[model samples]
Target: MNSPDSQWSFTAPLSAVPEAVNACLDQYFADSSKEFGSIGSEFGQAISYLKDFILLGGKRVRPMFAWAGIRAGLEGGGGSLSVPFPDATPNPKALLSAISALEFIQACALVHDDIIDKSDTRRGNPTTHRKFEEEHRQKGWLGSPEHYGISQAILTGDLALAWADDMLLDSGLGHKALHKLRAPWRAMRTEVIAGQILDVTLENTGSESVDDSLKVIEYKTASYTVARPLHIGAAMVGADPQVVDMLRRIGHDIGLVFQLRDDQLGVFGDPVVTGKPSGDDLRTGKRTALINLALHKGTESQVKKLRDALGVVHEEPEINDLRELIIATGAEETVEDYIRIHSQRAIDTLTAAGLSDAITSELVALTTKLNDRKF
Candidate 1:
């Protein structure tokens, strides 16, 4: 067994992920450009937008989780944990392609999400729709610029969704491996779409129940973001059924913690780091666990204040008051405690799986990095 310290020694810097994934994306685009012609050609603008949006910035967490799942699955087959180098496995290229597909799926989600949220920026750059809106205004296009932007953004997101499937099909996995991947792949897509619908419903209906909020988290963020990716990787390797189930459970816990942290950051994080104004969630009236707790525990006036602030962008001082109200109600601490509990639960699940040292160590490092992230 590798010691924890030694196991963690292999944890690659997060920065390395974008470099690796970007190379894959560049090749994907190069081949696509060959078939589709230049950026000015038919459907080329959407392709270029997706390329830039995906390659520009993201934590690349889903792909990393998928890769880790592959390692974990291989370990289950009694393989050696110390491989000495990356992509040294039997089916390295296929695995990388499959993993890279996750980013395209994520791109689809984010583009559609930005449209829904009416967000202007992502990763410190203009969102796809917003960028198109600006283009319409600059070009003096005929239709309403806002409508034109929405239409183009929708098409771009659809292109990403379609390409995600294409990438996976073209990943060079055997027929059997591809067959195995279908279940998780289809389920991931379904869950995210259902989750998005529920989220929009809750926002419109003004539901305050923690249970409802958690349901949204489970489908929208947790399953799509973590559990499904892990399962897909395990499927890619034909891992033991029991091992796959274990990863599903572990991924669910970690994914929930991941979203909770995002909710916190959405409200309290620095704009410079988070790449959005503080209290964006509050402004959007997203029915997060934190908000639920605040509503449940806050005084009547505080509840009123919160209700008033929800879905309406407020000035800094009002935003500060809302922040203070949430903090004063002790919701922040309670949510933090919940995060701690879930984080430990996930670690405990991972430890109980008795995975090889390398897999466990990487997962532990990922959990720590995710839980402690400021953005």
Candidate 2:
């Protein structure tokens, strides 16, 4: 029963999701400041920074996914924007709370990831840690600026995580429903952190075999980014156990394709479109899908050149050469083939599981859009 209006509207949901997310975010800030008002002069400012980061401009895919999951659980009973899922009788306040929790968790992961990658900026702005360090410099703080920034970010991420846990517990979901929601969040945090660790360990270290790199993709990129978000959405609304399991399977296939597409974008996407430097991944020697493919299939001489060019941690023409090698080796086409295969798998899984017509159609369209995304 997958339909275009319902499933494809994942994009349309964003128009409303941020507003919902903000309603919850506002509540969180107000509560935190009230509780910790007397702690320090900087507490208010610190909390503001946290809020700002959550509101950072980018796709609020996670929160939307959560909302969709909740709605899907309700199973299509609602009649209007204000009360979309009439059958589920979902509490508006509870829905906002649950979505906001996912947003905070995402913020935590991004804050830490930016620091680990030494990324100066994110979402077209200075990272939280970097922004904090600049403030310290202006204030003439005594310690390492980057270190101070990282420390503050770590604490900020911790606070967001704690807030997420509290929000989930307070979501007004029944005890059993709350438990179901919490499980995925816990697993996602663990996997993302482990992935971050692996990502950091590889920096300036060396390239890993395809199998090892794929494992990192499974943990670091695919599962938490897409699969878990979809699961969280489903779990929130009390989707059936079997349906939830099926969602996990479908989500994983599409999620990996999503990341593989992203890896391609890192090198080939337009800077204006991607909102980042061109060939950024190559500059960082990121062991992306393209690189892994080239490694597995490139000629011996090509491999030698790649080893020299990759992970060099600098800007150079060599990156262009590396990009060419990726193309020359037909890795790009191979990667595209993989996208097609995985995306079809997602469609097959959803159809086989007999999702609602609206959801099934929407998921397929969304998968197609994701797999074909340029930015």
lDDT leader: 1
Q: Write the per-residue lDDT of candidate 1 for residues 149-190, one digit (tens) a residue.
A: 899999999988988899889876667677777999999999
Worst 10 residues of 1 by lDDT: 1-10
Instruction: Mark the regions of model 1 whose C-alpha exceeds 4 Å error after superposition.
Output: 1-16, 38-42, 77-89
Q: What is the number of backbone collisions in each predicted candidate, taken in the order shown?
A: 0, 12
Q: lDDT score of model 2?
A: 0.74
Q: After the best TM-score superposition of candidate 1, give how far the Cα of residue 49 lies from its true spot, in angstroms.
A: 1.3
**Pairs in steric clash, model 1:** none
Cα deviation in Å at residue 375, candidate 2? Answer: 2.9
TM-score for candidate 1, please give it. 0.91
lDDT of 2 at 340: 91
Q: What are the lDDT figures for the candidates, one per model? A: 0.82, 0.74
